[model samples]
Target: MSRWSSETSKKFILVFVFLFLLYGCATAPVTGRKQLILVDPQTEIKLGLQAYEEILKKEKLCNDPTINALVQRVGMRIAKASGKNYDWEFKVIDKPESINAFCLPGGKVFVYTGILPVAQNEAGLATVLAHEIAHAIARHGAERMSIAMVAAFGEVLAAELLDLNNSRTRELFMAAYGLGATVGLILPYSRKQEYEADTIGLYLMAKAGYDPREAIKFWERMRQAASGRRKIPEFLSTHPADGKRIQALKNLLPQVLPIYEKAEHKYGLGEKIPEPHCR
Candidate 1:
């Protein structure tokens, strides 16, 4: 079957499922938004843990003791505040040119050294950590996998019902879910997921005693860094900076500031931020 023909059938099945929920869904934590997910959280976490281990084997870990300590410190603080019971581990990769960070399911975090300069200070790093951690806490990855699974299943059902060839349908399944064994699969979050991550991340950073304003500053620096470079690779593509993110943070500032203030009162917020030393 041609790609066009396969996609047409896939779209038709998707529309049918859209009008009727094929699977019972769950609501996102903190945001309380309904999500059409079919995958179990346990299975999702297992996939994440497996993928993270594979990634670590292919990537070199940073030898800088100071950087490693800082990542651990901030990561632990945010995890503690998130109040979600999960095993957490943090690692700093020695990639000096790749500006990226991600947190897999079950609280595993990987931060690239390339992002250190952009982060600038501990608070900046906290922002990135908090954001990625928020993704894991909210099970956004599982939700995405669930959506893909439903699409794939829909295709299979249609093929079986209509007595069509299943090979093309299988290909559509991979395309829809992006299941290639590429080195870096850049999974772009939905707009809703991005906003939820921002919101929960702000609260986490605040509870961890990091200034909420640093999150905005970190994003601004990230935007500047991206513009200074040539083009971003497809594997590293991020959401466009529409200024809405910053504006949203500003609106949420009032809610998070108090938490930051409370944490600071308990743990003195006058520690000097150290300068970054490249290895």
Candidate 2:
């Protein structure tokens, strides 16, 4: 029947279009790894912006003028050297118990007050800002979301192929991608990506006139911070520890040392950052 043939042809065309879209993937900066990101950059940035606004609304901001100014100063320098064209904003959270820093996509950075004691000074804070900004410049969060989109797409395609009339499949797909812990815990970046961020971050910090070597010291302090940690929470579950991460950075120091030296020379030698120890 002509009508039956027309319907079959339409389905074929749809499948062809789906495959074409899948083939058009993008490469990650610095690492140059091919990624199957179904979502556009605009979509990813919108989500990041929304998430950032939600966090600021929920968290108590640090009221200290000096601390806020310091964070903003260092954050701006790093953002400039990141070579990324995005609306950037930095905030210092008043939370004293949680020692963490994060840079969400589209240049949203947050530094908890608790981490400042460990950072000790301006250069130390620069180290934290540099690493967090590296995550944004490298598009690590976007890459993770892209992976989730691909997984969800696969689930839908699989369900259709199986001829399964199940709403649970759609629900499960949402659950998998919706949970940040999903990729953070199980499927993380290739070791290559971790190393790439370190290398790229060092250069960014150096160009920003911060001592890149402080990153090494910062991680050492982080390792000491997590030494007695018994259990991993969903958030910490995704990131690698200070020891493995620091060692990798050390190995790449030879390549980045010149950048550090230039930064130190240009910025004038800064006082040595003091090491932190847990009581």
Candidate 3:
């Protein structure tokens, strides 16, 4: 009788989880992939704003007018292409050693000065900015957090289902769950998000009148920059392999090139980004 009750409880929990997931289903833009995001947009935007404030407080903003203007100009164009009514803002961070850029929820974007050389020109900059903007538009951060929340809920459910009374058994089960969830689920979802962003970004840049093909060149330069560095294997890394990303971009060009050609005002490469003067 006890065994039957335990089995019944497990089945009930599974059904409840499935129903909950269905209630939280969302479709990603551009790619139209179904997502199970349990968080609301308002909450995500609020959290993003708080983090944005914290980051701005710690990072030095670039005072160079040219760099600031360039970032804003490119960022706004991409934001407009996204068609999301986010309160978009772009700023340049004065980090010469960090070749990184990111967009927080609600369209807050930051570009590090170090990446400008690799970006080379307006089109290359568009490639980078568009990709980051796509992440925000897709609410990837919120989705990731929701995934973590679900994983935590699963752990709690497992404990109840198994009736893990022994402390050692509970510890081992938690350890295994954490490893399995991270490697098998979370990491793969992260890489999928990266790929989805790349696909969406190509369309956005093309629509914004920047050449979509420039994305390939920019990534090639990135690959060259990291040529000698030790690379994390794709299965373990949060991002897809650079070579794979480049190939995926190549595959997508045929679809996005027409969007660029049809844009009312094509900038092609737009303007060359000047090298910053030594302070």
Candidate 2, residues 18-112, lDDT tens digits: the string is 64485337775655767654444664466566567667777888777767766787778778877788898888877666677777767888887
Query: Which digits, one per residue and each the tens of the lDDT, describe model 3 over residues 1-279?
Result: 698777866865785476456547888899999887655676556656655776789788888888888888988899999999888989888877667777777788878888889899999999988987887788776566566555655344432422324443333222222222212433234668889989999999999999998899988887665557475322224343477889999999999999999997899998999876433
**CA lDDT of every candidate:** 0.70, 0.62, 0.73
Q: Quick one: best lDDT, which candidate?
A: 3
TM agreement with the true structure for every prediction:
0.78, 0.74, 0.78
Residue 195 displacement in candidate 1 (angstroms): 0.7
Q: How much RMSD separates candidate 2 from the native structure?
A: 6.8
Better lDDT candidate (2, 3)? 3
TM-score of 2: 0.74
Better of 1 and 2 by TM-score: 1
Clashing pairs in 1: none
lDDT of 1 by residue, 1-279 (tens): 999878887776675465235434677766788877654566546656665776788888886787788888888988999997888999888877777788877787888888888778778888888888888888776666555555566344432422213444333322222233332344467888889988999888888888888888877877777786787622236545558878888899998888888884333232333543546
Q: What C-alpha lDDT, on a 0 to 100 scale, does residue 164 get in candidate 1?
A: 19
Residue 15 lDDT in model 2? Answer: 58
The whole-model C-alpha lDDT of candidate 3 against the native structure comes to: 0.73
Which 10 residues in a row give candidate 2 its minimum summed lDDT? 169-178
